[model samples]
Target: MWDPVTDAYVASSDSGAPPNGERFMLYALSQRTGLPSLPLTSIGYVDLIDSSAGAVGVTLVGTPATGPPATYARYCVARGTASVTSLVGFVTDGTTRLELRVRTDSTAPGTLSVQTAIAVAGRDVQLSEAVTVSPAGGDTARMTTDLRVTSGGETVRATGDVTVDTTTRIGSGRMTVSVNDGAFATLTLGGPDLVVAAEAGVTLTTADETTLRALFSTSFELFGTVRVLFTPVPLSRASPPVDERALVSPEES
Candidate 1:
């Protein structure tokens, strides 16, 4: 089962190989325009099994490629409205490349409708990508765009945003905050505030201080904790000891 709200798989079952040579059927269903729509896949053959309960269905067994361009397609057989022999679908096990395109419809101050589109499963489909609007003025500024991945009328991935900030020029802008994209977390540098926003269910970590420093300056205000190293130096020897400065400057000595 798929959870439309969370965009996740709820429960699943697998019947191994239809119990030795028993023929079974398979069906693939996807969403099309707010309804169940079928996509293009390679399903060579399928057979149906009728049960005493008046239900018709088939068991799905075998592993498919897990990752990018992958989608959840219901693989099952149905006899009629009240009799679905077997109800099963894809339980994805890996990541997919979710592409998002964002642009504003208008630059006027009121409510700039930022448009967005997400491409998944090798198909370009329309999905909402508007999270927040950009601040309007003669000068350019940053805007945040949110996205939710949906397929066959079910949300596959939850909502997230891709924000563009510091629009210095037409092509000279950086993503301030973004989520759900397959790319690395967004990196924002300004006003002494350093923010790192990773995709949902993903944790952000730096390998070492050098890597962190490269992304943020020492004075940056990080939202989380970090490891700091402090070196200790031995106290100056009792007395004035030797004057190394006078040694280097003979005239002063």
Candidate 2:
């Protein structure tokens, strides 16, 4: 029958000749336009075959994926006269997230995965490196990036990470040190020094249980609690001490 009011085809048969509804039109459009339609994982209306007594036809399921990427064919499960829903599912690398909703007539809740593609901003760099520079001959050394240091003390007193991308590089380019008398340790400069320094002859106790005796410099941010562990040492105390003929911050503080 024709829906004179809407000017579209109306239900002229009993419960609409077999599968004759919007689905029929959509399916026809897909066939004619060669456009793919949604796929159902499974299709099963509440029927007498598998349904117990008092059950009504109301379900459509797509074939489950053997492992992943389960393809769903477009279909519907009618409870009785009017109840339809849609569902889609797929998987992709964690670079992305997916979410899908499958509608239904029943009150029970159901969930289905929807998204399949994901991407991240950067390459997501995850790496660790340590470059130690012990300035010699009274010269400063610089680094290309920030640094992570573990000052020595019982059971290694300090451990921290920092990014040193600074223009004012360290004066000392690089050198090699005996790592706790174990082996030759190469120390190179990284970003703006993620600087660890001391006065001409100040000492710092490090985690390696070694008191870097003030043989050449003081502890790098060695005075206070280890809370300020990673970033640049707080300048308040690190600034040049109040001494005769000296500014708060030395020319190179």
Candidate 3:
């Protein structure tokens, strides 16, 4: 079963006795009733169990049914030693689907990296970010991000490094953005609001302007200080980290 609110898998079952035949089943708990469950729509399935196989193999896939069909898709499961080290998922706003990838930093114990890509509607955007939690105290962390957006044969890129106080949920940093490798526009953070300023003689093409507007509309609040559009999840209220290595095998890991 799956919990829509938490977006987590709760339970699973297999029926019909293994040796003879069996069928795998997936379910989701109804939010309205919270008693009876609902079966997930299975768009695809793969069977890896085989008696003739030379080695034991396992493949697991997850399909989330809570969100809009066009906006959500199944994720691939990566095997880890003690937990899931890597994850791949898809999210969309109907017009475009963004590919989201997340993984723990093997070299850095308490660090995480998130990458996102969007290639649609003549636009290609990619973002790579690294977030590291302070080992001395979990109340603080650092995030470094790089973003690139391309459209109509033009390209724009931005890079930022910020320190965040997990306890206060406040971040301070400066992001520098450039269009077509031209002069950069800087956005400063950590003050009352985000502040943006461009270098002298910075110019933009018609296509570049359109792309920037679309990006700002979807990702930032530009009225005063710029703020990213996101739903904040406080670390204090967040679930404990799961060791992804345990979820996968040695070969997969």
Report the number of the highest-TM-score candidate. Answer: 3
Pairwise lDDT winner, candidates 1 and 3: 3
RMSD, model 3, all Cα superposed?
Answer: 11.1
Each candidate: what lDDT? 0.32, 0.24, 0.43
Consecutive 10-residue window with the lowest summed lDDT within model 1: 222-231
Candidate 2 structure quality by residue, lDDT tens digits, 150-181: 23321211222112212232223332233333
The runs of at least 3 residues in candidate 1 whose Cα sits more than 4 Å from the true structure, single-residue gaps closed, are 1-111, 122-128, 131-142, 149-188, 191-194, 197-203, 206-253
Could you tell which candidate, 2 or 3, scores higher by lDDT? 3
Backbone clash pairs for candidate 1 read 24-47, 25-47, 30-37, 31-152, 56-85, 57-85, 57-86, 131-146
TM-scores, each model vs. reference: 0.23, 0.15, 0.50
Alpha-carbon RMSD, each predicted model:
27.1, 25.2, 11.1
lDDT string, candidate 1, 1-253, tens digits: 3344554434336353344234432324465544222342323223234443433343323334453333322223222232111222222223454443333233333323434444554555444444333433444333333444455655422222222222232212223322343444554434334445565665667663234334332111110100000001111112211221211101100
Question: What clash count goes with each model?
Answer: 8, 50, 13
Residue 131 lDDT in model 1?
32
